[model samples]
Target: MKLYQLKAKQAFPISKKEAWDFLSDPKNLKVITPDHMGFNILSGADRPMFQGQIIQYVVKPFPGYSTKWVTEITHVKEGEYFVDEQRFGPYTLWHHKHFIKEIEGGVEMEDIIDYKIPFGILGQIAQPIIVKKQLQQIFNYRETKLNELFGKLEGHKNYLELKSI
Candidate 1:
């Protein structure tokens, strides 16, 4: 089995507290994720995140099928960062860390994920064809959705500035 890592960072034109309040909640995952992915949270998000918190969800990574995913919040540092590891999921291994920091204009949120597919050789072969692209699309969708929700931050503008035009 080969280990894979995906890193993504985005600056939200919002305060660290606001960022933490939204991102740290498991229910918000559905809001940011693509609709076709069939992301649904089966756990409550009313309380603040803490270590050993288990969140359950159903995700349809492929068409006509759904899989249940369970992740345990292993570490949390209030407004700074949190870590989640997959307890039962599609992948053989999944470790995800989320970090938020106060930057020049807003809060910078970063996601670092390490995952390995299960089917050994076959999974490795499908990495480039399917796994990699699917993961990238998920993160890309998140970035776009966040930009729509919070506006764009300085140094990360993707669209043409109206002032420049």
Candidate 2:
């Protein structure tokens, strides 16, 4: 099985508490996500994020493909980090970790996602042409959205990378 990993990091000119408050609230996901993805929270987003929390959503990853994704918040460490795992989703395996740290004059947010695609060999064939590009676009949009919401930290180079593991 081929497992893929995506790592993204961005620095923001905002306080750690401020960043935590925005990111910890599940509803804000729609704000950071690209509108073209047709992302919507179906349920389990009425309250603050916590361990064991289940969040469901409807997402159109591609045209004519709308799917219901259910993810469980498996871990949460207040203002530091949190983990979400896919319970029912498109991928065969989806584990995402989000972290935030206080940096000089701001806060830095990091995301690491490890996932395995379905359909085995066919999925591997489509990885570069479809999956990887889609993920890149999604993260790129998120970075832009976050920069607009909270100004970027000068001299901090943000990056996003995807690779096989």
Best by TM-score: 2
The digit string of per-residue lDDT tens for model 1 on 1-165 reads 478888788888899999999999887889999999999887755567889999989999999989999999999999999999999999999999999999888988888888888888999888778888888888889988999999779786432111100
Residue lDDT tens for model 2, 14-73: 999999999999999999988889999999999999999999999999988899999999
Candidates in order, TM-scores: namely 0.92, 0.99
Return the lDDT, model 2, position 120.
88
Give the number of the best model, judged by lDDT.
2
**Which residue pairs of candidate 1 clash?**
none
How far does residue 63 in candidate 2 sit from its true spot (Å)? 0.9
